[model samples]
Target: MRTLFSKCLVAPALFASTLASAEVKLPFTLDWKFEGPSAPYFLAVDNGHFADQDLSVEISAGQGSLDAIPKVATGAYPVGFADINSLVKFLDQNPGAPVTAVMMIYDKPPFAVVGRKSQGISTVADLEGSVLGAPPPDGAWAQFPVFAKENGLDMSKIKVEPVGFPTREPMLAEGKVDSVTGFSFSSYLNLVRLGVPEEDLTTLLMADYGLALYGNAIIVNTDYAEKNPEVITGFLTAVAEGVKDAAADPMAGAQAVIDRNPAGNVELEAWRLKLALQDSILTDYVMANGLGDIDVERFEKALEQIAVTYEFKGEPSVSTIFTDAYLPASELLMMK
Candidate 1:
């Protein structure tokens, strides 16, 4: 009888050892630097969500939303976070790239035209005659034409200054540019930190103004996804759990980011995380339907909107762009 009990204990330990040995290393790339919006991914690592799925995830920060598509397409990184709209353009240009979005993260994209009210720019129409600072590779800048077209703004009248990402916010703060294109939560909070009053800022979120675009999503190298189907599902399941936990305790999520970024302020990051949760992540559609999935109708409409500005080399299809086959059952994806 003693031997039987000993065998039971040893069996559990052996299983654990085997599971640990079977863990796969997945390198993940993010759409941007370590900030409040990126806390959930870090939380996934810190909270053992990835470990629970037998994945060892190493996260690296990216320069912009467009940065990770090629990295994942080339199979350099198995998975990455990036703008879905940019992915559409990339596949259209590259034609048969091995990368596609697997999960929808930002239901309501944070793209916006952020301007100072004091600079006589309180509305979208105010942008017509203003000097707009836009980074060439920015996802928001890429979508600006669609926003302008929907709002009936004449682009020819607007003075566009091509600014680098580092100088984007500062140029607006220093009055060099009246407005800039960027993610709403990121630009708004950055300007606040730079001594710009909250009231002085006018953030015209494109979604609020008739843009039907979705935002960043979890993208994967299709070749990698095909070879390891279970790994893709497990990675997404862990990501869903991480997003849920981060939404539940935003301060904890912010701490995870701060731990990774020693220079990050916990208070600021917490505030930023909350803004993302409210503005982009936990939208009405997402809260009702759960995370990591998209409404087919909405996604199709978004594609039509993307076509407004970009001249596609070939027709884009929903199936080629995203697939929910690797997502866990819907029950596990519920945030609230």
Candidate 2:
């Protein structure tokens, strides 16, 4: 009986060892640097969610929202995080690129025009005649044209200063530019850290104004996905669990990011993660319906909005841009 018990224990241990050795290495690329918003992914790695799915995920930071699309399309990376709006444009330009958004992370895009009240900018109209600092590659900047059209702002009147990502918030903080384009949570907190008073900032979220668009999503190489559907589904399932874990205890999520980014501030990252959860990730729609999926009707409206500024080379449809095929079952995605 003792010998039988030892074999039982040894069998499970050997099985676990086999599973560990069989883990598929999936290198993930993020849309931006390792910050608060990126914590959930890190949590997935740290909390063993990826390991549970037999995936060994290695995340790499990206330069901008558009950075990962091309990398994934070229098969440089199997999966990545990127702006869905940019993915639309990229598909239009490239035509038949083997890349598509698999899961919707940010229900409401954090795209916004953040300005200081002291600069005489309080509303969207104030942007007219003001020097607006914008990074050309910024996802928010890319959507600005649509926002302007929706709000009836004459683009010709607004002086757009092409600034680098690092300089965007600084120019606004130094009073060089009246306003800047960036993710609301990122720009607002960055300015606050720069000694800009919280009350002095005017954050005009594009979603609140007139823009109907989705934000950053989990993207995949279609070729890779086609060959390994189960792998993609498992990856997304792990990510959903990571998001839920982060949502349940934001500080833990923030700690995950800080672990990866030793230079990150725990409190600040926690605050940032909270803002993302409150404003973007945990929306009413996501709360009611669950995560990692999109409302087809809303997605269609977003595509129409994108059409206002970008001329599509071919007809864009829900099937081409996004698919729920790789998303886990509804039960696995629900967040409480």
Candidate 3:
């Protein structure tokens, strides 16, 4: 069954770009295969929002948030995507990681425990003692155990099987494992494409488990943000406009993603990203509070969860991770 971002929900998109028509340079990276959920970034570039911001943008593909975060911090790219879990860990260990968020692309974290509904999996409790799957447990997605524990799950009972990424989707469908880890944009939709009905799938995302993992937060170095607030605002303006356009028309947005997928399940996963976003993205809070809404309360809550899970001593300071000075809520004005 199609979710909110399906064909039926798409309306005519508004493409008013709130930027000057000139070339400005902004380099960026994508954390995974370019498809579906990556739409808004591509849409803004395609629709000339970046140009309207007087910016010329370049997009590159990195393996995942793990790779992108360091690159952004080191200036390999001025902007990149990383979920909240990584940010929490980085700030805990190295107070000088030098990154702050621009916007949350996905209002709900997409990391999820995916399994066959046929396996009698209804909740995290049902998967007790079950072996869920993944490739490497060393990277950003490693937060799943913390996610599991946050939900009152006994991590010792739930085993993690390191099945390589290539076989991740089929293994779950074939019942090769009890459950497997994947993003809603990547795995859940691929399952539907492989003939599993949406109703037959069970997903327990950390977001639903009270862990509130923030995915694909557009990030820039703190130093860059301090000096080039206008550039940051310009990027935010382009991104926010693209998000609105996608929410208004997903097929066109999915097409933006499909154009970038070199291989893999192109349209199938694109459709899923569309569904996933509409199910819980483009929040009223985001639109109402203005583009790139950074909820300070939510950020602190995530830090609190991280401190509990990782045993950090105390609250990390606001200066270590976030700075609102880059984005004035006043300048977040969309092109009228």
Candidate 4:
């Protein structure tokens, strides 16, 4: 009995040592704080998806969507989650920065103008005469110009209140602002958390109102990816697995987030995760074509729409901004 017990202990220790030695350390940066949307990556870590790929990924929270672009470009992080539209402008400005989106996570895009019905902001037209609270650095705010132009909203009539992320929802809740530009999932839930009734909240998702732009994606350091192509492929495979597992049981994903951020309310975050999965991540196209891939023609049209509001030094190409080269098989990307 003593001999058998000692052998079992020795075997586990040896296996653990092998795992530690073989694991590839890859630090990943996120577009925002540890929240419901961030749960899948945490699930991947907790569920050993990354381990299955021989990767040891450490996730770091970012200031905003644009924050991770420079981080990965500078090689501070080999992988990151960020807004792909922001990446288009970043690449255009930087010229040759070694960063590109490897996977498409937010297929429908979450950009929206969230307002309180009590504040007289029930529709897009209501925004013209009201105060719209917007964080200058927010990904949703960045695309508001296109939304306004598409809906024939005259910017001159709208009162633009530049508020910080922390103050955005509070200001809206306090009736200091008529509306706010933010992600549909984030802002709606934030308001609900602050004691606003669901019926009182009016969400005008940009994607629903003529905006065809894609949303956040997993970006990779091109320099690193070139040398470690297999690592990139493996990393994406693990991420897909995480997304599939999380979608099947969203509460599990929410638990993973709460485990990391104990301050978060599990029920609220679980709802947020569900919103992101149902409204943003899993779309008709993603369901049919599988995840991590984009329609090239639609993407080109999105760039054209962006050009209407943003001046470019050079033309942006879909190939340069995003690639499926690092994506896993179609079967792997299909959500369960």
Clash pairs of candidate 4? none
How high is the CA lDDT of each candidate model? Answer: 0.92, 0.92, 0.71, 0.91
Q: lDDT tens digits, residues 1-336, model 2? A: 569889998999999899788999999999888899898899899999998898999999998766789999999999999989899889988988999999999999999999999998999999999999999877789889999999999999999999998999999999999999999999999999999999999999998888889999999999999999999999999999999888888899999898888998999999999989988999999989999899999899999999887888888978989999999999998887
Best of the two (1, 3) by TM-score:
1
Q: How close is candidate 1 to the true structure, as a TM-score?
A: 0.92
Model 4, 52-134: lDDT tens digits are 99999999999877789999999999999998889999999998889999999999899999998998989899997899999
- Which candidate would rank higher by lDDT, 2 or 3? 2
Off by over 4 Å in 2: 1-13
Task: Please report, as a residue range, the 10-residue window in candidate 4 with the lowest summed lDDT.
Answer: 327-336
The sequence of per-residue lDDT tens digits that candidate 1 reaches over residues 192-288 is 9999999999999999998899999999999999999999999999999888888889899999999999998999999999989999999998889
Model 1 alpha-carbon drift over 4 Å, by segment:
1-13
Q: Score every model by TM-score.
A: 0.92, 0.92, 0.83, 0.91
Model 4 local distance difference test score: 0.91
Tens-place lDDT digits, model 3, residues 1-336: 777676444432322233333356889887776777777888899998887888888888888777888888887788887765676677677667777676666666777788776886778787777777787853324667667667778877867788877788778877778777877556777676677778988877767788655656788987777788899888878877777677677778888877776564555645766766654465555556555556777877776666655776546775566555555355453322
RMSD of each: 2.5, 2.5, 10.9, 3.1
